[model samples]
Target: MEEEKKTVRAVERALEVLLCFASGHEWGLTEIAGQVGLHKSTVHRLLATLEDKGFVSRDAATDKYRLGLSVLELSANLWRSDDPSVALLPEMERLRDQLGETVSLYIRDRAERVRIQAVQSKQAIRRVATVGARLPLSVGASSKVLLAFAEASVREAILSDPAWPSQLDRSTVGKQLDEIVTVGYATSFEEREPGAAAVSAPIFSRSGQLVAALSVSGPSNRLTPDRMHEYAPAIMEAAHRMGTISG
Candidate 1:
């Protein structure tokens, strides 16, 4: 028990030291120690341990430490374990082909929905979202799908935000969200981006948590009201495929 306790405490201290680099600035031993409230010597030992593991690197010139490529390697490995984007690509491609419009996958990050993957339609006039593009979680079909299935606390927090886009009528949006949850998908027209329309459905993890949202999007001219309705089932089928395959 004593040895286990020591091991846990050491792990915690090491994590605390690493977190000092969260500001993205190179950190010196003194700065890290001060930030983590540990002795400089202890911080140095922790940094050395982390450096050996490739989580951080020390600059010989400035005697400062920055995050190392090993950290990125670990990040890549972690995401690769059950990456939603990777699992959804095949389905997204099928949906894009079927709808002949751009299909994007989004995952919520706090107040934002970030596009992690997109398959563009061959149509010259079709809409496209770049991977890593961050869009507001308060608007659009993908964002609405996320909110409709998000935890109550997250939903309340966004709805409570004073600076949330003024044009989105919450009452009307609330009713629409209820319908989205009931129907298992969302549709939006000219809400997030003017002249664009999208249909989105939630992708769930094995545990049934909403892991991401998949969307089909295009210019409103091509995705008119009837067309959006027409495309809904394909999008839902793709969403289901993503959820089924994604861990």
Candidate 2:
């Protein structure tokens, strides 16, 4: 005898509700209902379930819904895998060509970032941080990224050390590191060298350990906030692709 197949409408609706947030924006119940083409009560009930599971959150002031920390946790897992160096360099060069900015790859070297790869921009006014150059992990975007995702022991050792850079104190630097973990990237504006601005994305090894950072930097005037925002998505997309390939 053949048995009829069964489907769960509630589960399907829940997934659709989650997808509505793909634009990186928040939503209210009515808006979510409209987006998902569901009844208002049904959407509200689904939201409650997602909230209980730490998948969504509601703003008390605006009564809007947003993705929760759980999303970040899931993303952080991707950054935890694969040593992506070989798979990353070609794309980095391509990104450098596409953006007309300096691209650099760095690996953690005991609380510092050692530039292991780079592709310089053609523009004469561009930034010029060369390979094998060592920079403090407490100041620049690349170094801070390595620090943020490092193992607890390594992270604590550097942060609590007396040698923490005199230019930026531990607490301030610590907050910045926390933010990097939350947002998945880092930014620096002439903090290391005057006239330079940069944004950086982290690279991870296949086993999920922090390995290196990839960055794009240039003259601050040209690498303005809008420019960085425009380029950030491509930078992150390249990183995520490398993440999937790094051994």
Q: Please, what is the whole-model Cα lDDT of each candidate in the order they appear?
A: 0.86, 0.84
lDDT, candidate 2, 29-84, per-residue tens: 99999998999999999999999988999999999999988887886765432334
Task: Please tell me which predicted candidate would have the highest lDDT against the true structure.
Answer: 1
* Model 2 segments more than 4 A misplaced: 1-87
Evaluated against the true structure, the overall lDDT of model 2 is 0.84
Error of 2 at 23 (Å): 47
Q: Which candidate should be chosen as best, given TM-score against the real structure?
A: 1
Q: Score residue 85 of candidate 2 by CA lDDT.
A: 45
| Candidate 1 TM-score over all chains jointly | 0.68
